[model samples]
Target: MKNNLTKLVKKANAGDKQSLELVILEINDLIYNLSLKMLLFPEDAKDATQEILIKVITHLSTFHYQSQFTTWVYRIATNYLITYKGKKSKEFAMPFKEYAVLIDSGQSDTVSYAKNAGELALLEEEVKVSCTQGLLLCLNSSDRLVYILAEILEFSSKEGAAILTITPDNFRKKLSRSRQKIRNFLTNKCGLVNSENPCRCHKKIDFLTHQKVINPNNLRFAQFTKRSIDLVDQIGDLEKAIAIYRATPAIPAPETIMKTIKETILIT
Candidate 1:
C-alpha cells in the first residue's frame, strides 16, 4: 500500500489529476480520523481534514520522498492540529484535575430514555466514544498528539518522534507521561477501566440524551455496522484505558467532504 501511495505521489507531483484524486481518496479517512481524535468534534474534524488535505495537495511537490509518505502527511496533520484554535479546543481547555472534577459532578443514575435494549446499546456506545474523546482534550496539545500517535495509533516512538520532529527519547517520555495521566484518570473515574468506578456509559446515557449532547438519530462516533466490543476484541492485551482508545474505530470521512476536497484540488 505504501509503495502504491509512493507511485501515486510521483504521478501526482507530475501533474496527473487522477493520481492526485487517488492520493486524496487513499488518505482522506486517516486524516479525518486523526482530526476527529485531535479536535474531538466531527464537524471541526471535517473542516480540519479539508484544510489538511489542501495543505497536503498544495505541498505535494515539496515531499522529496525522504520519509514515509504517511509520515509526511502525519507531520502536516499534527502541525495543524497542534496550532488549531478550534471551538472544541477552547471549550475543552482545562487540566485533568478540573476535568476529573467535572466528571465527578455528573449524575450517574439518571433515567435513560432509550426505548429498548438496542437503543440503550447505541446510547452507551455514543457516551463511551464521547467520554473517551473528552479525556484526550484534557491533555495539552503536544501531549495529546503524542498519546494519540503512540498509544492509540500505535506508532513506534521513533516514528512518532520523526513525525513530531522531537527526539525518540522525548517522544517516549511524553507518551509515558500522557499515558499515565489518562490511565490514572480512567482507573479512578471510568467504569470501563475499573468496574469499581461509578461512571458507567449506560448511566450517563440519559443525561447526554436529555441534554442533546448525543442525538439518537445522528450518532457522531458509533458505527452501526460494528459495536465497540467488536473493536475491543481486536485489540490485544494492553492497559485497559489505552485499549479503549486503541479500540476506537477509524471515523470515515463524509463523502461530501471528499467531494469538496477533490474539487478544491482540481481548482488548485
Candidate 2:
C-alpha cells in the first residue's frame, strides 16, 4: 500500500494534476484532521486544506522523493502554517448543530471514555477539551509549530529534524523543552500531576488529535508523552498568549497563490 501510494505520488510530482488531486483527496481527511488538531478550528482546517491543495499543486514538481511524499507534504503544510501564523482566536469554530454530519470519511473510530452499561452516572470521566485549547494558548508560534510537527504528525526525531531544518540532536532538545513547557503550565496553574500520572499526559495528547473520542479504548494519541508532563509554566496571561493571528495583511487570495506558484515552482 505504501509503495503504490508512493508510485502515485511520484506521478503526481511529475505533473499529473489528476493524480495529484487524487493523492490530495486520498489524504484530504487526515490533512483536514491534522489542521484542526493544530489550528483548533473547523473553518481554519477547511481553509488550510484548501490552501494546502493549492500549494501541493504549485509545489508538486519540487517534490524530491527524499522523504515519503506524505511527510514532504506535511513539511510544506507545517511551514506554510508557521509562515502564516495568524492569530488563533479568529479561527472558525466547529458548529455543534452540524457536528455529527461534518464527520470526515477517514476519521478514526476512537473512544476515550469507557462504556459497558450505565457509566456516565458514576464514572469520573476526565474531559480536557479546554486543556488542549489551553496548551495551544501557551505555546508561541514557533514552539507550537515544532510541537505539532513532532506530536500530531508523528514525525520521527530524525524526520522532524529534517523538516525543521535542524539537527536531530537539536530537535530532541527543543522537543524536550516543549514538553516541559506544557507540564509546567498544567502543574503551576491547574495543579495536575506533571509526570507521575501517565494517563493525564496521554489524555492531553488525545484531546489535541480532535478525532472521534467517544470510546475510551479506541483513542490512540501520539505516544511521545507517555513518560512525562514536566512542561515549564513560563507562559503568562491569555491576552499575551493569544498574539492576534493576522492573514499576512491579505490581498486577493487567488492572485497571490498564482504568483507564488509561478515564482516558486519550476516546470518543464
Candidate 3:
C-alpha cells in the first residue's frame, strides 16, 4: 500500500489530476481514521482530514522520495495534529451517538462481543472502546501523536521518528515516556489494567445510559475486533497487561466518514 501510494504521489506531484484525486480518495480513510483517533470527534476529524489533504496536496512537491509515502503523509498529519487543538476532552467522553447505529448495523457476527449479548449490554461494551480512545486525550497532543503512531498504529520507532521528523533516539525516548504515562494512568484508573479497581465498565453503563451518552440499540465501538495497547516491558505481567489493553479496538472510520471525506475533497 505504501509503495503504491508513493507512486501515486509521484504521479500527482508531476501534475496528473487523476492521480491527485486518486491519491486523496485512496487515503481518505487513513487520514480520517487518524484524525478521529486524535481529535475524538467526527466533525473535527472530518474538518482536519480535509485540511490535512489540502496541505498534503499543496506540499506534494516537498516530498522527496527519501521516506515511504505513508511516512511522508503521516508527517503532515502528525505535524498538523501536534500544533492543532480542537475540542477539549477535559473528561473522557465520546460522542457514541454519532457512530452507534452505523457500527451496530455493520458489525460482524464472527466478532465475539457482538454475538452473545443483548443490544443494551453490547452498547455498554462499546463504551470501553470509546473510553480507550478517550484516554489519548490525556496526553498532550505531541505525546498523544507519538503514542498513536508507535503504539496504536504499530509504527516502529524508526518509522515513527521518520513520520515525526525526529531522530530515532528522540523518538524512542518520547515513545517510552508516552508509554509510561498511559500505563500509569491505566494502572491507576482503569479496572481492566488492575482487576482490583472499582471502575468497572458494567458499573458505568447505567450512569452512561441515564446520562444519555450511550444507546445500546445503536452500538458503535464495541462491535469491531479489539486490539491491545503495545506492551511495555517495563511493567507488570506482560501477558495480562497485553490482554487488558488488547480489549481496546483499533477502530476504522465508517463508510459514511469515508464518503464525507470524498465529498469534502471534491468541494475543496
Candidate 4:
C-alpha cells in the first residue's frame, strides 16, 4: 500500500492521468467514509467528500514528505469538517430526542411499518444508525472528530494527533473526554448497551413507524449487501457503548462522487 501510494504520488505529480485516477479510486473510500460519519447525511457526505478530494488533489504539491500521504490527506479532510457549518437534514422528521420523549410517554400511537419480523429487524438496525448518528451531532465538532478518529476509525493517538495537528497527549485527552461523554449518553439512553435504559429499538419501532422516521419499504442505513459494523472482536478496555458505536457499519461511498472525481482528474 505504501509503495503504491508513493508511485501514485510521483506519477500524479507528473500529471499522469491513469495514476491520478488510481489515486482517486484508492483514497475515495477513506475520505467518503469519514465524510458520511461526520456529516451524518448521504448527500452532505457526498458533497463534502468531493470538496475534500478536490482540495487534496489541488494541494498535493504542497504536501511535504514528513508525514504519510494518508495522514496528510486526513489532515485536509479533518480540518474541512472542523470548520464546516452546513446543516444536514435529519434522518427522521422528528428529532430522535423527541422520539425518545414520546417513547417515555404512554401517548404514542402504535403502528407497524414493517410487514414481517425480518423486515422489522432490518428497520431496527437502521434505527440504531439514526440514533447513534444523532448522538454524534450533540457533541461539538472537535470532540466528535476525536471520538470518531480514535474510537471508530481506530487511529492511533499519534496518527490522530498528526491528522488534527495536535500533540498526541492532547489527542488522548480529548479522546478520553469524548469517550466519557458518549458513554454517558448511550448508557442513559441506549437500551441495547444498557438493559436498564428505557429506550429500546423494538419499543421505538412503532413510534418511528408512525412518525415516518423509518419506512419499512425504504430502508436507508440497513442494506442487504453489507453487514453491520461489528467491533465485538476488537473490544478493548474502552466503554462497551463506544465499542458498539465503533462497530456500526460505515456507509459506502456513492458511485456518483467517484465518477465525478475520475472525470475531474482526467480533465485536469
Model number with the top TM-score: 1
In angstroms, how far off is 3's CA in candidate 2? 1.2
What Cα-based lDDT does every candidate model obtain?
0.85, 0.49, 0.66, 0.75
Clashes of each: 0, 14, 2, 2
Q: Once all C-alphas are superposed, what RMSD does model 1 give against the true structure?
A: 1.7
Compose the digit string of candidate 2's lDDT tens values, residues 1-268: 6687788888877767566556765656655555655665444556776677677777777877777777777777777776553344334333322222322122223434425422321121212332344345345556666666675455778988887677888888877777667544444433233334333323332343354332344322212122112222222332211211110011122233334433443232
TM-score list, all predictions = 0.94, 0.55, 0.75, 0.87
Clashing pairs in 1: none
User: Candidate 4, residues 100-207: lDDT per residue as tens digits?
Assistant: 465465332343666676776687677777667667766677988998898889899999998999999999999988888778767777776777877766667766
Better of 1 and 4 by lDDT: 1
Give lDDT for model 1.
Answer: 0.85
Tens digits of per-residue lDDT for model 3, 1-268: 7778888888888878778878887767788778878877665777788788878878889989987777778989988977776654434433334323222232222332334456534655655656556666767787778888877677898888888888989988888887887776667666666677566565556555554455566655556633232232333655443345444555565566445544665445
Screening candidate 3 with a backbone cut-off below 3 angstroms (N, C-alpha, C), the clashing residue pairs are: 228-245, 228-246
- TM-score attained by model 4: 0.87
State residue 232's C-alpha deviation in candidate 4, in Å.
5.4
Q: Residue 33, candidate 2: how far off, in angstroms?
A: 2.9
Is 1 or 2 the stronger prediction by lDDT?
1
Best-to-worst order by TM-score is 1, 4, 3, 2
Go through the candidates in order and give the C-alpha RMSD of each one to the true structure: 1.7, 13.5, 7.6, 3.2
